[model samples]
Target: MSGGVDSAVAAARAVEAGHEVVGVHLALSRMPGTLRTGSRGCCTVEDSMDAQRAANIMGIPYYVWDFSERFKLDVVDDFIAEYAAGRTPNPCMRCNEKIKFAALLEKAMALGFDAVCTGHYASILTDVDGNKQLHRAAAWAKDQSYVLGVLTADQINHSMFPLGATPTKAEVRKEAAERGFSVANKPDSYDICFIPDGDTKGWLGERVAPVTGDILDREGNTLGQHDGAVAFTVGQRKGLSIGTPAADGKPRFVLEVRPISNTVVVGPKEALAIKEIAGNKYTWAGLAPEHPEVEFACHVQIRAHADPVPAVAQVVSTTAVTGIDGTVELRIIPAEPLNGVAPGQTAVVYVGTRVLGQCTIDRTVSAVPVSTPEMIASASPVPVNA
Candidate 1:
């Protein structure tokens, strides 16, 4: 249990359904200024107490399991590494994959639990063929189907999301209160729980030493100095100290972040408009769809908060490269131009509310250059002294 009202209510629902229930809280790590004490978030000493309180209210047992090392290796390390490679990573997805379902679920099964349950706002149903399928929750706004889409069929069969049919967050809280749980008024947690302050860059900088680099324009002209190439991301407008203004006096946008050369490329706002994105490491909720020669229409979401945009997806084959591992790429062309489509972010494909699949964006392809070839040929190359 996550020590939240939702999970508490979920446990109550299971009890109301006449199922034997036991609460398990993962002890991720110790918080500062607390001796074996839990914080308000999951895995903290405080959270364990909260879970125990909920369990007691339902007359059930609760225990805390330490999974700090696994959390660091699986979730935290990958988060930092993805950012270092100029890609935005989703830690929630990793946590759901490694911690919640894989690690905790296994432990729960070993302890004699028939199935694991959580407060996730998604549902799992068996089709006519007895195959499990994940569906969106009744609370559309709070539905977490996107992150939970990474679950395998095996994991889905053994998991339960009791809040899947719940109408709203308020309803869960009301249930918790009516059941006499103490955590009914507790606020819902947001962002990465481990990084309590939500300073992703700060947390990454402390773990991985960022390398200082040069900021350059499209024509390879040295514009300014950046603290580190990893610090800048595509479409970032702040912190760039480019003195010169654009031809129309508009602010410059980060077009690319090159980790190989440790360079941040800046250009006009128009350069940020990308028509297509190529991605790798494809993960689908079910069987991979047939790779059609023509682009297949689908809804693509480049970022978590981004509204799913209508797009056509096609499979692109790639030759063996030196370090790149994937042999095939997923190409997505949005119905209209999209801005700030950064590499390293996920492109989650959806058929209505059901997530079809997801892949990591490798690069964005812009249209033809606005500047003339003769004008670019006349400019001298600016050297970036490493």
Candidate 2:
């Protein structure tokens, strides 16, 4: 439980259902004794206390598990590394994969619990053949199946989402108020939990050493200088120091981010169009799709808020593959154009709300004029660092 209204109501519902419930809150970090209490987000000292209080109110046992070291190494460090390599990382997915389902489930099993339950909006159901499947939450707007798509069949088999049937955020708050939970009126967290101010560039700069680099136009002309290449992402138009006006007098878009040379490439809006995307680190929920031969069609989601686009998916072998880290790539051709597909982000595939699989974007295929060859070549090779 994160001491939120949903989790508090979930604990109450579990107890009302007569199932033995034990609330476990993983302590992801602790302040350095310098930061004050009630600081903005969860995993803080006060948040843990709120969880404990809710558990007590629900008349169940509660405890705080220290997983700070693992969280930092697995989630935080990986997030920083991905950005430094000029790719966007999904920390929520990482947290679910490494901490919530993996670590917390293992610890719960060791404690002799039959299953672990949470307040997530998604649901898990069993088919006639005894195979487990994930389903969408009743609340359409608050559905989080995209982030939770990385979960495997085994994890879903032992998980319970009590609030999956709850349709709206308003209803959740009402339930919590009826149950006498104090956090019903608490505001929901809107940004990344760790970085309270939502300053990704500032947070990354402080976490890792910054390197100076050049900002170049599509014609290979130096537009300006950037503090670090990792500070920008593809399709971003703000905070760019390129004061040079485009030939057409229109705005420019970030075409690429180069980590090795520490440079950012800018171009006209038309240069940002991509027809195909190749992804690595592919993870299917159950069966693995055959490579290079069998192609399937599904809805592919490139970003969290973007609408799912119809696409055909094909499995391809990596150009450079060895026995140790051999990778499988999934190629997606969107049925229509997508505006800002970024490399190093996840491409989550779904059949309705049933998560088919997910993969990390390794490359984007775009056609450019021969005159801009120098600019494209100078922008770092595709999937060089990811």
Candidate 3:
């Protein structure tokens, strides 16, 4: 349990179901203090106490597992690396994929556990043929299946989500309060646990060296200046300190971030319209579509909260990429042109509400060719949206 109302209530429900349950709280940091300062904070001592109190009420054993080392290497470092490579990554997905499911699940099995259960808002269904599939929770607003879309079929088989069937957060809170759990009224964590202020740009600035350079328009005209390519992302609309306004007065958006040349490229929103996205490191949840490896229709969600759109996904072979035989690619035709389809972001595929599979988007093809942005030869940077 994360010592949150949802998790505490989940534990209570598991006990009510007559299963032998033990509560575990992950100590994800080597230095955890109640005042660690973030969304959920770090030094889980106080959180552990809250968990212990809930475990006491549930009358189940509780323990704290230290996975700080593994979490840093797998999730934190990987996040920094992706940004340095000019890609935006979903750290929560990495935490789910590497820490929660892969590493933690392996440990659970060794300790003789049948499945790893959590408070994630998603449902798992088993077919008559024993095929397990992941689906969105009934509560659409709180659905988190998009992040869990990275799980493979094997991972799905070993997971459980007790809150999936729960109708609403209000109901969960009510139950927690009725059960006399103190965490029933705890404020929800809204920032990244490691980032107390949720200032991603400020945090990134400390680690990524600044290389002041040009911010340019589609026509190669210098619009403004930028501190470093890593500080910006695709689709960002503000902070380009370009004094000159466009002749047409249309707003500009970030078309791309190039770490190599330390360049920021801005253009009209249409330049960001992408028709096809090819991804590497694909994972499948269950059986492939009828054609097996050929392109097939499915609904694709590019970012969390983005509506699922019509698309086609296929397994494609590449002679250039050694070792791996092939990679999965999604040819997405969004209902409207897709903007901000960033590399390193996840593209989850679904059929109906069931999660079929997902891929880490690596490249995209615009609906039409976007002009190569012109470069500015000087520097006078400003904050984004400033």
Predicted structure 1: clash tally = 5
TM-score of each: 0.87, 0.90, 0.89
How do the residues 1-386 of candidate 1 rate in per-residue lDDT, one tens digit apiece? 87878888888888888989888888776547332223323556676788899898789988888888998899888888877776667888888888998999898889888788888898876668777777778777887787886777678878888899888888888888899999999877776777776676787778778787888888787878888877777789987987878778889988887776778888887887888877655666654566644677888877656777999887765443213333666778899878877776678877776676777666677653755331111011121110
Enumerate residue pairs that collide in model 1: 37-45, 38-44, 38-45, 38-46, 39-46
What is the C-alpha lDDT profile of model 3 across 89-175, one tens digit per residue? 888889899988988899989999888888889999987898989999999888889989888888899898999988888888899
Clashing pairs in 2: none
Stretches of candidate 1 off by over 4 Å are: 31-42, 290-295, 320-326, 367-386
Residue ranges of candidate 3 with Cα displaced over 4 Å? 31-43, 219-222, 318-328, 371-386
Best-to-worst ranking by lDDT: 3, 2, 1
* 10 residues in a row with least lDDT, candidate 2: 377-386
Candidate 2, TM-score vs. the true structure? 0.90
